[model samples]
Target: MINIQSGIPGFDQLTVSELTEGGIPEKSTTLIYGPPKTGKSIFCNQFTYNGLSNQEPCLYVSTDQGYKQVQRDMTDFQWLIQNYIQNQTIYFIDGISHLSGGKFENKNNIVSSSVSNPADLMVKVGIGTRNVYKTSNHFRSILDSLNTLFAFNPDQMVIKILKAYLRRITEAGGTGLIAYTEGITDPKTENELKSLFNNTIRLDGQHIHIKSDHPDFDEVQYFESTYTITDNGIVVNENNFKNIN
Candidate 1:
């Protein structure tokens, strides 16, 4: 039997039953998809921070901005640089440059190989390394903002990239949450990606709907949670949740 942990407080109360009934493991792949400004990034940050607070190592892969900018934004959530971020157990990989064919090491050189798949790029960039591990213990988590990839076509190259990325994380016995914005409007592509995930979480408005692909589960559950951006970070009011089981 696999035990899945809901990173969100109060939110877990509504999900625990379904997760247990489905037997989804702890170190599994979760997809959080929604429109822009729906608190996707904040949710990822909170999930990552939860792991860090538990003395678990986490890797945050950002395709939209550099590490410095993310760090700055996180500071508003009461996340101190020296205490919670800098040289800590949480590691950040600034993947924004990699999208524009920029070299990971030398910012000057233009990368000849364009990597559409983030999972492959993660390994190429040495994300799973001792240096990355030096920061925390949980040593397992991923947040890939999928907006960058939608710029290209939904071809096998894209699928291969996602597959490679998820495989790397799962193989290492780590769990991950990949974020996808509502850009690639093609239903076929969306369905294909959905097939790859073990669980799918949609943040629509102020509600979070969760679904699992496990055979033991056949129903989708909805929960109400408040989304707020504050100085201390994204605070989710899980206690006010009501399950749509």
Candidate 2:
């Protein structure tokens, strides 16, 4: 099976290697959900940096912040993606730019577009993906914090849009990582959304759990793996914290 190596060392060791072929499964989408401040965004940043480092083009859709903020955040973590941005290997769809004084003047001529709503986001994503595909056949996309989309659109509408968009990612031979926040929806609604993805990475505070239909995964052994976010990225503790539920 095709796979892409996630840059985070601990994630690759504790989850990726055990669940898939030494990395995230290619042509499939993985949902990353967790409470706020649990390093979900950091995980995504690390993944994108890894992809860019490997010469895989990336499309990052930001529903919560502008592309500059994302750049600043990653830079703080010492994951400098500015070079990728300059070369157009990494593209962005900024959904919050309109909210914050419209689109900021992009002096770098980076491959990014601004969207005001979910409808616009869909259109921009389609355009963004097509553009990125021109750079490489194998690419990755990330939707940072799906919670913002849920806040503005009906649950069903968001799910419908996400499902279609995710399918497009897979069809184009690309992998996707969608970050989501837990406790925003009821359990039933949450489960429904989770069911759409090929894999689920749940971050609960300092503990993380991965669930997949792949038979090789030993659910009992991998449950509630402990981790801490450092400047480099996620660092998984060797001892699993079984009681952190």
Best by TM-score: 2
lDDT of 2 by residue, 1-245 (tens): 56578787756555544335545767778899988999899999999999999999998888887888899999998889988888988988777776767646643223344333667678778777888888887999999978888887788888888998898777777789999999887788899999898788888877788765433444422345788887778876766634221
Computed on alpha carbons, the lDDT of every model, listed in order, comes to 0.61, 0.78
Model 1 Cα lDDT, one tens digit per residue, 1-245: 36544455544555556446332246678888888887777777767766666667676677666665666766667555445454456655666665665446522111112335555555643544344444433355665576666665355666667787777666666677888886565778788888898778777667676776554456554445555555555445655655556
The residue ranges of model 1 lying beyond 4 angstroms of the native Cα positions read 1-7, 18-25, 81-88, 98-120, 125-137, 152-155, 215-231, 235-240
Candidate 2 overall lDDT versus native: 0.78
RMSD of each: 4.6, 3.3
Steric overlap count per candidate: 10, 0
The residue pairs found clashing in candidate 1 are: 56-138, 57-137, 57-138, 57-139, 76-231, 77-232, 77-233, 89-135, 89-136, 119-165
TM-scores for every predicted model? 0.77, 0.88
What is the alpha-carbon lDDT for the whole of candidate 1?
Answer: 0.61
The alpha-carbon lDDT assigned to residue 169 of candidate 2 equals 77
